[model samples]
Target chain A: MSAKSVQMVLYPDTHLDQAAETIHRLRQHGIDDRDISVISGVPYSDKILGRPMSWTRIGLIGLAGAVVGFAIATSLNFGTPYLYPIRVGGQPFFPIPTSIVVTFELTMLGLLISTFLGVFIETITPSYGPKGYSPKVSDGHIGVLFSCPTEKMDEVKKGLEDLKPEWVKNPEAKL
Target chain B: MAAETKTLSATHSASQEGEDLRQEHLMHDPKPREEMNGMVMEAMQTTSKKYWIALAIFGLGVLILLFGFWGNQIITGMGVTGKRRPVFWALYITTFVFWIGISHAGTFVSAILRVFKAEFRRPFTRAAELMTTFGLAAGALFPLIHLGRVWTFYWMIPYPNARWLWPNFRSPLVWDFLAITTYLLSSTIYLYLPLIPDLAMARDRSTGWRHSIYKLLALNWRGTEAEWHRLRKAINIFAFAIIPVMFSVHTIVSWDFAVSQTVGWHSTIFGPYFIIGAILSGVSAVVMILFIIQSTMKNMKYFIRLEVFDSLGKLVLIFSMAWAYFFFNEYLLHWYGGYQAVRDLLTFHAQGPTAWVWYTMLICNVAIPWLTLWNRKIRRTPLAMFIITTLVNVGMFAERYTIIPLTLGEQRFPFDWGAYSPRLTDISIVIGTFCLFIFLYLLASRLIPLIPVWEVQEGQMAHSTRKLGKGKVTSVAELE
Candidate 1:
């Protein structure tokens, strides 16, 4: 039977150099990249940390939202005029120049609203339940959260401790 | 040996200069993130007796001037104010445009600066963004206030209803509704996205009701690599997308006048002219607010340094020039075209009973900025900047006054021509909205983190002084 997984937390200072070295050491251990996460006060680029780029569908979702907005705008500008035709002078039922304003406004509205929702969706936010988190991470401390087999926890902890983290223990472990 | 001694002295001087530069710029001055977080939290928590007194005054202004007059107007009707046939759109619309112009300050400072990678925008981006949200809130009220039957304002909404009558999309009024709604939502979201991490920072530190509210608002942010990555990507997209939206909003506002049959109002230049005016006024308001924040808030002196005012002053000067160019272009074209109605209006504006408004616009927007902002010493002085920026807004208000009521007063036919002036209701409601804006900002200052501490920390991390020749220059690394 496979050994049950246990999450370990390694707290480093705000500097990227130390965080990079710690991440490198974790990779040298049998830990896969997917099992590791870095929590930080400030955002550090993936290249600096030597970590693979984190994938996000926010852009795609925003584009899809723009498309939806465009459709709604079109329906309002072109489609609705047909429902209740209020002819003004000899102007067309749907003037292209005038319609552009509504179209552009709605399209951007979609892009922005959807992009905002994308953050919530991608992050699975508003999650109030318990998880592996540390308050110190927000105080400019870089926290490396990774899971390893329960049997290998001590060995990984020993490797991480050599780097002199502020603390290293089970994330859920009570202070 | 003499040459070696001279070289050592030169290097020492250059190093000293570099240290001075570091002290001057916020980006070069590094502070521990924990300390920054604490400073921001302390600023939010700490409120003096003066703050309460000021809040009470603004709150009373909102209740009495805004709500009280607005209620009186609603009960009495539109006849309480000056809204004659030719001069239908007056001070209410002028104030609306002014507030909308004010809203541009946030987008200009936050999104535009972010896109250009201007490092000086780091400390007070949140302050400007809050202005955008609240400014829009204030501006959005004018449309309803202008309405005779304010309850029927929902007729502008593009929706299927019992009447089955859809709003005419061709109308600029409808366009205003759509554009303002979009800009408000987008800017609010933009504001919230960046604020999440800060909310998390606040949440981690606080307890009781403050902790609960912060936790809810923070959306359970863990500051994980994935959350930050997505947030950064989203913010980048917003920064680019929001600029054009900002332009479109003021442009549509200009269209509300431009599309009209009124002689002075109908001009293609109005779009860009209005936009430039909005930016000028917006950026100036930002400086004024920054001055207030720096003076009032705790530990803000470190974040909102002289360098920010200096940089923003330069922008205000450039925008002032741009506004002057557009102002001159519009007037010159109308003069050169020699249209009778346009000629009469232009002549009246310069030499009419209310020509002081026109002169005030020129003196405040053009003369004051051109005269003072050129000097580096004046630009760096916060008190001077606050005074100059305040005058600029006064000038912008005068400009809007010229465009709306003054222009409307000048009819093609002499028989139809009549003067318009704001009644007690008009003056009171306008004051109310101003009070409401300051009131919202005051409440927000105590509730939220006014500075983006992480962005400041990030900028500090990226900045370092590097020696080029005899002198060391400030160098910044492109982190993202």
Candidate 2:
């Protein structure tokens, strides 16, 4: 597969709204929102960008983890006593009060661990591969990394430049 | 504390360099995002000689007192220290509960403020979160140190041994262990999850070894919209879900004592009493640390402002009142019951040789907060808040001393009762742990961005001022 980053434009502080307009321009020019990316130092939600909300599997993963954690908690809490059934003052084999602690801990444990892993899995983090990233983005520049056709590259650059971005860079990625 | 800051700003305040007077607030006067990033990075990179000297002292203490003394105790049996008769719990347990109390503030301050969307929480969230992880580490250590046979500490695990006897499901120690482990893991993960974006930011601007380290930690984040969505969702889940877990951690820690048959420790009110007391101490510790950081660290004055100290002081005041209520509830119950053992314990706590310490504890924890924290000037004053919170911590330590050692030493049952004067080694070990906590925190500040610059930037994005009738007021747009 071959992909070329059409243009990278830097928008300063409040002029970040111009980046939104450029994103709108990209969409109007038949660029799929998925094909075009908005990169910035800070996180901006879909509302700010006027883009569709991105779906995430993190919540579902957390819910699944809670169920699994509860199951483990139940097994440990209920089944552990009988394994070593030496009577200690004739207490109940398994008490609900003690079991509640284990279950609660496990449930939260599962939620957090899964939510953490969900980030790595869903976001495909730790990706050291060649990405169309710019250093200026971290310096508070609002950058838009968009993909356009090989032939239409000039037109895309012209569109972004019209928004008066500080500078636009062309990128080449080969796989 | 406020006076020190007044002095510090006159002397130690980082070069404002033509910064607007209004820009003293982190929110109202926003710096260029790039400039803010530079400020944070510079703070991490630049370590003063005073910082290194403090670090060297803490580092030496950690190497010798924490590890060396602990190693010596591990070789010699548990007999070298103060554990004897009824007071077998002694300073170890006291310090354990103390560290655990300190842990609660970080989660309470960070998670509660985040859930409520209190904008002032922006700058100090990372600092408080760091305290949570490090404080738990310190708290977990006291238990291991308390176990004279430290190597076999894994015996507390629920798995069956060769005799096939598993850990008793009914033990509060097991519950405390579980809660601590769960909380440490949960809070550590919680701390790291949001730190990812900031780490990525650090990675973007660095080269050489620093770049490689940040690159690996950042998980190659590029701040894509999908990535941000998932990150935000996960952080939100942690924020809401972790609150109950935070409460459970401290409550279960209290159960370790409340479940016991000891005269003063066996109170049903211990759970809420411990929670309230924990918050009082925890919030105070946060203030103490924030005061130090704001005063000493480079460029921190711009982030940690008077409003932060003011809000935190308000929280300390509320927790102090709640603590008083819970303490009074326990006191009245024992007084009304007229049990001889309970009566003896109370008398010893109040009228014994340590009576002055007890009265000072009351004055510091209850009377002083009631009298002073209500004043806005005092609350806003960094120095005043520091003194008040420091006194509250002293009172809290005194409270622990009264509960654990004194109550255990002077018991109703004569056979199991004995005085527990801590050996110098025991005192050093506790001091070592304190130094280790500070050392770990000092090291963390250098590595991680203490302020979440991205979050601050996002906050700056959401926050703006608008004209309302005749005056301008700050308004924040809900970004999510």
Candidate 3:
């Protein structure tokens, strides 16, 4: 991509409705949906962001973590035997009922930790150093970032500027 | 400059003729950010000779009761505790249930209200989460301490050793360990995730070792669009998932007793009973902490208003009723069953050595919140609510004590039945745990932004004034 065409930043009002309208305007243009991004101080859903559905595999990752946790718990509950053997309360060598607790605990631990890591993996967070950012965005401003062809840069900026963004700027710095 | 200052004071006195309505609120009397930060830092840093003296007292208490008393108990072999043959589980188990119940308020405040988007919960979520972490920390210790040998705690885990000793999975105690451990981990993670943004804020505003500490904890969070998006998605998922986890934890804790074949402990209704009791106690603790924070901390009164206490009071009333219903259900079922051991435990609870504790528990847990919280005036009054909430906790603690050791006094075999008296060490450790909770909370209050500023701002954005025919009304929108 050419330098001018690679990125654009638009500052919309904090109002939700206005932000939505801005998204509608961009989609009306030929900008590919994936190229658009919305950022705000608070968390907003995709529907609010005016984006297509995100295919986040957070749930699946959590499920995988749970499986791993369950296996470990089960092995610990049952496998310690060949190495050494101990029996208490005269119940059984391997107890399914008690093992369930350990399994559940491990499953939850796995799910929570994996979900946390999943957020990092999905978003690539903790990004320090110079990047395309504005601290005012955190003070109740909606920022919309998009990409388009260099020839269409003027057209895209004008099109977005017509929507009355607070400020429209070219790529200032790369994140 | 002198002329302008004189004019400002002249205007200030003219405007401030009335009761100086500003002092009524901590939040309304807002200070500059730098000033507020300095106040918080001062509170953290300004430990006095008196504070150290008190800490030393507590430390000595810990030494005497925990080490000395526990040593005596071990050398004497569980005799220091009133745990006789039939009532093997005594004061320690009672304290376990009590502390676990106290832990529930944090999850209820942070996760459930967060899912529903309660604005009032924004400021105190971290405070509540601290309660959860500290409560669980204290609660977990009881089980270990009750194990007596204290060293062989590993036997609780499933393993094959020369002894071939696998812990009984059917036992509720084993279930409790897993459930508590899971909840502790989940709650800790949940607590930390939201604190990242606040830690970054702290980092931005700090210097020296504090800056480094916050920086490391902030994890280089720069509040990027992608980062916010991911954090939002993760939080929403967690909010929904954690509610069930919190519910499961208390239910499992309840089952520890309910699953047993013993009379008072064997009822099917005990599961819901324990859960309601937990929420009742938990909500009261939240109210008490809110009161303290609002009164003591700078910029807190504005965020925690009478509106919050009003909502919490209502919850306390509702949960109080639910607890009463469960209590009646369990009592009636056992009464109707006419089982000898069940009736004996019930009678023993009412008329035995701990009879005063039994009656007081009923009055405090059921009667006070039920009667007084119903009135809006009493509910909104901070002092009144605080007293009622403290009583609720006292009542909840008594209920656990009666259930654990007191009921155990009435056993099937009279020869094995005995009362439980906590050794001196038990008392010390319990105090230490309380001190530990307060110490951690005091440290956290200064270090972390107890009020989630971003969440509060989000809530404020969702709220606005709308005009109707005659007056203005507050309204909220579904921003998400």
lDDT of 3 by residue, B50-167 (tens): 6567566656655665566667767877766656667787777777888888899899989899887776677678889888988898788788777889888887775544766556
Query: Per-prediction DockQ scores?
Result: 0.69, 0.65, 0.27
Candidate No. with top lDDT:
1
Q: For candidate 2, lDDT tens digit of each residue in B34-139?
A: 8888888888888889889999999999999988888888888788887887688889899999999999888888899999998888999989999999999998
Number of the predicted model whose DockQ against the real structure is largest = 1
Interface RMSD score of each model: 1.7, 2.1, 4.2
> Model 3, stretches more than 4 Å misplaced?
A1-39, A46-55, A70-105, A123-130, A134-175, B1-79, B158-168
- TM per model? 0.97, 0.93, 0.82
Residue range A1-175, candidate 1, lDDT tens digits: 5564546454545556777887788789877887777878888889988899887899999999999999999999889988877787977766999999999999999999999999988776443222467888888888777666778777877987767776644576221
Cα distance off (Å), candidate 3, residue B209: 2.1
| Worst lDDT 10-window in candidate 3 chain B | B18-27
For candidate 3, give the docking quality class from DockQ: acceptable
Query: Candidate 3 residues A1-175, lDDT tens each?
Result: 5543445354533456766776787678777766666655566767776677655667777778778887877776667543466556876777777667667777776777788878656645334222444444544566666666678777766876756676545434422
Compared with the true structure, the alpha-carbon lDDT of candidate 1 equals 0.90
lDDT of 2 by residue, A108-150 (tens): 8998899888887876644322246666677788777776767
Which residue pairs come into collision in candidate 2? A126-B219, A126-B220, B1-B382, B1-B383, B1-B384, B2-B382, B2-B383
| lDDT digits (tens) for residues B300-325 of candidate 1 | 99899999999999999999999999
Better by DockQ, candidate 3 or 2: 2
